[model samples]
Target: VTLPPKIVPRINICSWTYSPPHTHTHTNPLFPSDATLEMSNLYAEQKGKTLNLTEDELLTFYGILLISGYNSVPRRRLLWSDDYDVSNTAVKDAMRRNRFDEIMSSVHLVDNMKMTADPFFKVRPLFKHMDDINKTIPIAEHVAAWCKQFIRGKPIRFGYKIWSLASSSGFVHQMEPYVGSHTHLVETGLGQGPSVILGLAEKAEVPPSAFKFYHGNLFTTLSLVDEMTLRGDGSCGTMRQTQLHNVPFTAPKTFKKTPRGDAEYLVEVEKLIVRWTDNSVVTVVSNMEREFTETEAKRWNKQKRTMDKVRQPKCIQDYNTHMGGVDLHDQFVSRNRVNIRSKKWWWPCFNWALNSKDLLSFQRLVAQTLLLRHGTKPSRQGRRSSMAVAITDATRFDSFNHWPCNTGSRYKRCKNCGGRTSFACGKCDVPLHVECFKKDHTE
Candidate 1:
């Protein structure tokens, strides 16, 4: 198949007397040398002046320009040389470095101080909409009042707190005021240190027992021994050292042979460590006391011609089950996300909260539907009687002098009932029995 010609820019190098073309062009297409020169020339042509850029700066600038022009296109379809890939990586690295600088400048680095206590550092706006909903008080005061009311009401239904906690990024201080003194179960992703977890629990007026944190491997490593050492087999070199320094007490080793004829090991260090057969370790930090529990799984055994047993820690099972509630809520929120882009740092967060409210509203509606479906049935007559009652409740009647009925019957039947008609509704223009007319119109 004949491939289309590559789209190369037509540059007028005649105007450039200082730099020679040999200094820019390269033999290899992958490491094209002229990328910087081409960008510099283009910049000069556009602004009608030369840019005094260093070699590194020129490469950086060229990358940004390249991305700005074609980043929207798919990577495979981008008809550019391999140099574009190198430039893209450089641009991303530069951005990451600059982001770190920006964060350091914006945030204060403090050891023991509570950043949430800063009154001016608001994580969320006081009121998203103020003009129509709340006009009597200042936005701040209105927000305060609303928080108190929300706390008292406790808007979320049961079994949905995990969804709420995860979707909010586990920032308890923002929700603490609104949640009041009620203890709540909070779930958080990795990077939450001991200080952060305890601080959030304190602000939320809940004990550490209420928090279930998923500590990241990096953060866990800082506090605990290497995961390899904690494996059940005691094969890793550091097992003896880990037992002496890290664990308080190690459980008796349990073994179960898998269907694949491989032995699986399981061990627990009371409440602290749980090492499963998969060589994964979990470090639980909580104030609540939990007894070690195990669950049995059935596995096929070819030699025995029967199902073999596989043991799993209850902690690991629970973690696996409940950890993704926030993720599910996030997926729901992302479906109708607002696509507005802005330079303001907080705009992304603001957009997220706005989109999240829609999810919460939907959850409430679903809860209501479930309640209505399963809740107590009201004491009433038959279905027809109930329909009559509903229709009567919705409508009212007025008297009229004469009403025409299109019914061809010599003796008209009641519109509401099968009984012979004696009266007619003036407004509805329907003939009705005296009793049916009174039932339909009497309020």
Candidate 2:
């Protein structure tokens, strides 16, 4: 594939020249809000600069550019490279269209709990517009066609964090056939904190009931399986790790005997296919920097040790096993600190206390950010976010609080109570009450 010439040149220019001030006036609006994002670039400062990206020696720069996007502290900041840069021309376009600034400003406003439009701006139009409906159905059919046409009929995996990635649902819905129609659907990339483990437990890509959640901190999920087997036999005797219902845990039926027959690894196999990993194992957050503040970071590391300690017993009692110290990746590695006090190896910073309450609270924070990026909602002070999508007062959406609490969020409408909620079962923390949950469904 041919590379974009400006991609290399533009990135290098920005990394070297752009060092944003640590504390800028938040109200100054560094970039304007009234620009169109799709048609603009944010850079014009490097007009005369010449950067060659078509050289063989420069090919390595593309890999670097891509990895930098992954390794950067926040993962959002762009990096410089010898080649394959996004030009200042692009930045200028972004600013002129007010796209980048608007997106960022929208994220910022939502994090602060500001309203952005009625929250369901697109959703309302989505339901009403036949053209929009026409656009939605074919993507999934195309995905299935592409897979069958190219891959010679193999199972496929589809994924999205239903709660946090509500915007992605359209694409997923379009691609729904590839997921629901007998493909090896795999999904992951849950949040990085305690939610990481809970995400695993919820089994977003997989069914929550299919697997058990163990408090035991195995060297990895593989090690956990090794311990779960019957004495010298290959039987998967029943024992619960992370519990949902009274489901029996079974060993790999056809899968556990392959060369690297680790059933624990099955969940990621779907990811390998979707991301073009070609059925090979690849690492995402492999070499982490573990950076954090001195005083607070230490406290977090210590608490993790305590949680690790607590989890160790459950792991051992259930599966006649033992392990060394807990691993950060197993639980969480602080940016760069050690948790010396966590009775469990996996105590997280925020939701380590209560999964029920804290999970919703943190997710709410994330949802607010999403609202600002995609809506016409104004903040409390009426300082409109740049990414705000304008909808008339006649148009309204479910509040940010009404977002689905989990990946399988179903909009529900209450019958008797005339309320709208997201949970079909009237489950608490589903982002709406039973009345609203059911009402939304009926309406």
Q: For residues 1-443, write the lDDT of model 1, one tens digit per residue.
A: 22222211100000000000111110101112243344434444455554443334333322332233223333321212123332333233333333222222232112113345432223222221211122221111000000112123456432211112221121112232222222232433322322333333233332222123432221233232222122211111012212333344223232122122222122333222433433322233211123445576566667799987766545444444333433443565556554334464544443444343324344334333333342332233123334444544454443434344344444776777877765676666578765676675654
lDDT of each: 0.32, 0.22
TM-score for each candidate, following the candidate numbering: 0.30, 0.17
Prediction 2 global C-alpha lDDT: 0.22
Writing each residue's lDDT as its tens digit, candidate 2 over 193-266 gives 22323332222232222232222211123222332221121111122133212222222232223222111211
- Model 1 lDDT, full chain set: 0.32
Query: Could you give me the TM-score of model 1 versus the true structure?
Result: 0.30
Q: Hey, what RMSD does candidate 2 come out at? A: 28.6
lDDT (Cα, 0-100) at 75 in candidate 2:
23
Candidate 1: RMSD to truth: 29.2
